[model samples]
Target: MKSLTAGAEIDAWCTKCRMDLMHRIVAMVQSAPKRVICLTCNSEHNYRAPRTETTASGVHVRARNTGPKPSPAAARVTQKARAEKERADSWSSKTLGQAVDAFTRYAMDKSFREGELVLHSKFGEGYVDKVLEGAKISIMFRDGARTLAHRAN
Candidate 1:
């Protein structure tokens, strides 16, 4: 067998592509391929040799259940949805407009309290999540969470 180096062609299982395809050796560890890229799919990952087995009919087949893992965004959305459900229970008493009226507009020259809602000229609307001693407040916006200056007055 010839020595393998970077860019050498090899067969690997692409987790994303979920198939045994030709791959280019990316990095070698102790004369063995450590990382590779699927030429057919353009996915890069650790080199994984495909597992082959024979069935009752004596046909060669690649193994199953070697696909990509679930993405983190799904878990994050699930957690965020659960938290929003909890927050909705507490906010159930107020309508959208009523909720908006409950919070004051955010102003750089104004002070704010924690858990209060604030309308920003640029960031739209958000709820004050926390208040720090350094004139800063963590606001939870629909887009995500952010921190802004407060109590400039």
Candidate 2:
């Protein structure tokens, strides 16, 4: 039985290279193979031998396979979704009155209370109570209740 010391280099078999090659000592355990790593393959596996300190250039170099890496289709979809969201956020660039008009029409399907703060893209913030006849919409403000013509665009 041999004692394994730190920074020792040893000869070990590399499964990747299918050959016995030199490896630098990285770690060790009591009564175990010195945890040899292959210099050529740069792989670490348990070995029964202690290693010695050797430079990575001292080992025989093997040709690495230069295969094409696969493209990620999922990553492309994520990038496109992010770009679309940025474009949609520019809707705030519209006039406040136009924005209010748009939001009011959109909120037609939703209900509002009497004193609740409602944002009218054009008129800004106002309170709502009831709906009147024709295209006229009622909004209660700090001044009083005022009716505005609602137009759909």
Candidate lDDT (C-alpha), each: 0.76, 0.55
- Model 2 per-residue lDDT tens digits across residues 72-149: 887798888886665334323322244444333225545544333456655555655445566555775433456765
- Scored by lDDT, the top model is 1
| RMSD for each of the candidates | 13.4, 13.3
- Model 1 Cα lDDT, one tens digit per residue, 1-153: 888999999878878888888899999999899999999988889998774421322342233534477679988999989988766654433224655577688887788887787788887777787887688988776565688888833
TM-score, each model? Answer: 0.43, 0.27
Q: Which candidate is the best by TM-score?
A: 1
Clashes of each: 0, 15
lDDT of candidate 2?
0.55
* Deviation (Å) of 105 in candidate 1: 1.2
Model 1: lDDT of residue 121: 82
Q: Give the range of the ten consecutive residues with the poorest summed lDDT in model 2.
A: 49-58
Give model 1's TM-score versus the native structure: 0.43
Q: Which ranges of candidate 1 are over 4 A from the true structure? A: 1-60, 64-95
